[model samples]
Target: MGVGLYLHFPFCQQKCNYCDFNSYAGMEHLLPKYLSAIKQELFLYKVHVSVVNSIYIGGGTPSLLAINDITTLFDSIRRNFYVADRAEVTMEVNPGSCTLEKLKVIKMNGVNRLSIGLQSFNNESLKKLGRIHTVEDFIRTYQYARQAGFDNINVDVIYGLPWQTGEEWQDTLAGVVELDPAHISLYSLTIEEGTPFGRELKAGKIKKIDEDLEAEMYENAVKLLKANGYEHYEISNFAKPGKRCLHNQIYWRNEEYVGIGAGATSYMGRVRYTNVKEIPLYIEKVFGNDYATAEKEALKLDKIIGETIMLNLRLLDGFRMDDLTKRFKTNIDQLYGPTIKVLSNQGLLKEEAGMLKLTDHGLMIANQVFQRFV
Candidate 1:
């Protein structure tokens, strides 16, 4: 089985008010050390990983990385890893950070896919979300990416923003459909505890939208994107036929992948581990050849099965019971037979074709079903 490689870039021009990702705003100066440490971490893999089918350069805006650093990162990957010829290499780009010159260089250096984070089409919503890019800037950057010869594109949009009207939400969907990107990721806004949005929410300065309103927005997205020829392949992802994200699918399938760079996580064999989040410490440790590993856990069989059930349920196509039994040596029902039966009785889940999947209503309150397994 081929592995997926994830490299995290934790530098951004500014942090979004809602972002809780392990990214820093004024840490651009740490790029060189971070890149070198990532390269070293790549060689530290002891397992005999033969081929890689996907490489996702994700994070605090990978497009902001210097061209030379980008080239060096890819060059090291090519030299050390047997990357497949048609591997889906994706990089996340933000509108304000991407330039034609930089994007072209990244594209030419083996990046076939670009995921642009365009949270909203409304300039007012963009400002409210503390996003640096305007609607026009996103348009220009997207057009520039296409001009740079990227055919496989994904656009990420968020709905249910504070005080967002249905008309505004529909406009955002229409704008994305007009772009016709190969893939689209639609998400409802969630308030994380430490984010500015969360603080504002706690202070009663900002209010969370009603659950019914959020559900309506989500349902609208499903209908609109499906009508536009995009398949709702995952709970939050839609793709044109054969354009589903392979890297993310690996995770959904509960397969192993090595995540490199600061604040990265890796799942190899039965163990799951994460790298140190602190940049200076990560650099020092990797340079010291300790791989900057912060913590590691050998997941128990029950926990693994719980993870399998939780992750696979997110996919629309679902997963095979026979395959899980083959891999984990555990019967399907033993893992969550009682819970599945309860959910099925409640019309939150359905079983057919030797596979189990979430129902339409189940998708609305997926967290409730997911919590049972956890």
Candidate 2:
């Protein structure tokens, strides 16, 4: 399989309060220079990566780019790499940031998928989350994307907000399901240390939702999405049959991928590396040296085996035991037999028909199961 490509656009119009990603607000002035630096960075990897099966343009909000900028980015990609003829090219868009003209231009430039960030349908919840767009903006964006000829669309939603209720959560799920997009991603809110929510949490001004409530929300999502004809393929993702996000599957399967842009991480040749997080520094380094790698680590065999298991278990279908053994040229039973046995006894994991997978119960506390391997 060809390697997957990920390009990060690290700018947002207004940073969300709960986000801890390496994205900045009030940085639109750097868009042109930043894109140019990305092109230069891609050139450095041309020899190492010859073919790409997927291209994911994720961000702070990639839809913030101007038409010319979008055109230039794709032109650079085609010039530096051999993107597959049927490659899955996806771009992330914030509801209010994208216009019909921009969506049409994006489709014309070869983006086959659009992941819209529509955190919640409740106007109050949107305000609490620091989202600039309203429910109306999202509906407009979705309609415009359809009119622009994009059939494969993914809607992203978050549960467990500061004052969110079960009824509100249910409404958001129902609204998105009614739209019937090709894919859906449900994310539980995490209050990261440096984010506004975190500070409020520390100051006793905001509280994390009760753990039991969060779990209930997740379980409800699984049941609802499954009944609505969506497959629970990964922990936080669901898709209609044959509509899974191929780019993310590469990560879950522990396959090779190349990531471009500031703070993006890439794994190739069993070595993982991340580019610099600061946008200005990233651009300067890339323009000056054609590279901006800030960290790199080469995995040892045992580490790779453990990490591979941790990653593959994210897939609901599980990984084949035979495939693991063949790839590592070792006995799977010998390495994790005792651990697997204990987990299986606790009903957190199961092995059958030459495949190992998480049980329904295991999906709830998957982090703990993964810890046993890693």
Candidate 3:
């Protein structure tokens, strides 16, 4: 019953070509500005979250900061909010930048979870993704995190890259499974319109992998991870029992969380809001002690129910129709019964043990299911 807190660290050693998130390179001069502004923004929202169950420090690359500044950020959170004793405090680290000493200080400052970006086991794949670190760097970073006493860690990887053969994908899956990290995130590459990948694709310089191959890659991930005892809790995330990312679950479950820093998002009281995407504008507003909401919308009536169905369905366990009925005080059958019946008949949805959930087929074409609700 605790709130979740998300902090964005916008610094990066170098921006990846596939990334469109509001992270910056050559921004060392702005680090002090970001830190000061982030603290003020936290204070602005201090009234909402008194007890936090999770805190995630994500970024262009959060590990790019000095350990002392990272500690200060955590300290500011504690100074303003009461983090639960066992809260999942996580920080995202890139393989290139993390060091043993820094990880130890991060642990000492109360980070219990570490998420390392290890996009692939193959050096060529890593190069294609514009990752600065090599396979050996990831191995060293992982070992150091363990030596620093991190038992819970997550590794991030991507599939569906150009020239990624099935054999290569299988080799990657085998390597990652052998490591047995607490969590793994398997993402499909998405080429955003303004990114380098996008331009290359538009110019016929790069080609996407076959759709069938992409689907098979996902299938392989699900099969291999589950066979190894990792629960496919979310479409992209696999975790050992009782180790699902509490912070990200706050997102998938559509619960309330406050986000701090540029381009961050927040959801609370049935309202969703986003901060300024540009760092300079975000820093200016927050440092001036003003609210940094660049866009906001209050979800009510149909919007709330629609959003609930869309988000909660992402969880494998799914949400109960009865709870949705009680919360919004409407009969679920009256509102969505026909849509449900049609989808169930199409083999995309099923109701079991009084809960409505997407079938494996549904997860494969999850967008179709979402479209029905909207």
Candidate 4:
């Protein structure tokens, strides 16, 4: 299979309360330099292939770019490498910033998938989360996407926010189902230090609910989405039948992908590379062919297999023994013999239909299971 491509745009209109992603609130002036550096780095990883099967342009909000900038970026991709005609080109949008006119331009520029950031359908929750868009804005954005003829779209929603009730969560899920998006990403709220939520939490102004309540919310998500005909493909992702995120699947399968822009990570062949986090430094390095990649690790084969098994288990279908053997030259039993046996005996993992899969209990306690492999 061909490699996947990931382009990061680290600009947002306004940072949300709960977000700690490597994004900035006001850095629009640096976009040109950033794009030039990104193209330069893309040239560095020139594979022989003319096209990759998937290209996901995620961001602080990629839709924030001007039409000309978007055109130039896609033009660079077309010129620099092979892009399959049916390549899943995704662009992330914030409902407040992405107007209908912008969505039209993005669609015309060959972007086939849209991932809208709509954390909740409640106005109060939106305010608490520091989101700029209201519930009505999300509705309009969804309508505009459908009007623009984008059938493969994803909506990102977060649960377990401050003061969110179980009934409110059900309402959010119901609103999402009414939109009928192809994919939905359900996230549990996490308080990251340095974010607004974190600061408020430390000051005792914003309190985190009980862990049991959060788990209940997660279980509620599964039940609600399943009832709406969305398959729980991965722990946090649900899709309509076959609408899984291909770029993400590549990551889960331990395949190669090229990441552009500040703080993006790439795994190619067996080496893992991360770009410099500082935007100015990123531009400086790329301009001089000294693109200051912060880290590079040559993975050992045994270590690679272990990592692969760990990521692959995140999928509901689990890992294939045959494929695992082919890649690692050692079967799962050889490397993770004790771990697998213990998990199997505990009914957390099992061999079924010639593949290893997670039990219902396993999915809930997946991180614990993965720790054993690591």
Per-model TM against the reference = 0.97, 0.98, 0.98, 0.97
How many backbone collisions does model 1 have?
Answer: 0
Give me the candidate number with maximum TM-score: 2
Off by over 4 Å in 2: none
Model 3 TM:
0.98
lDDT of each prediction vs. the true structure? 0.90, 0.94, 0.90, 0.87
What is the C-alpha lDDT profile of model 4 across 30-94, one tens digit per residue? 88899898888788766534468899998888888888888888888888888887788999988
> Could you tell me how far off, in angstroms, the CA of residue 298 lies in candidate 1 after the best superposition?
0.8
Which pairs, if any, clash in model 4?
50-82, 51-82, 51-83
Best candidate, lDDT? 2
lDDT of 1 by residue, 1-374 (tens): 78999999888899899999999899888888888888888888734477898999999888888888889989998878899988999999999888899989998899999999998999999998999999999999999999999999999999888888888999999998898899999878989999999999999999999878888999988999999999999999999999999999999988989899888999988899899998889999999988777899999988899898899999998878788888998786777788889999999999779779999899889999899888
* Comparison by lDDT, 1 against 4, better one: 1
Compared with the true structure, what per-residue lDDT tens digits does model 3 show for residues 259-307?
8889999988888899998888999998777989999989876777877
> What C-alpha lDDT does candidate 2 achieve relative to the native structure?
0.94
How well is each residue in 1-374 modelled by candidate 2, as lDDT tens digits? Answer: 58999999999999899999989999888888999899998999998998999999998899999999999999999999999999999999999999999999999999999999999999999998999999999999999999999999999999998798898999999999999999999999999998989999999999999999999999999999999999999999999999999999999989899999999999999999999999999999998976799999999877888889988999998988789899889987788878889999999998767779999999999999999998
Query: Any idea how many clashes model 2 has?
Result: 0
Sort all candidates by TM-score, best to worst.
Answer: 2, 3, 1, 4
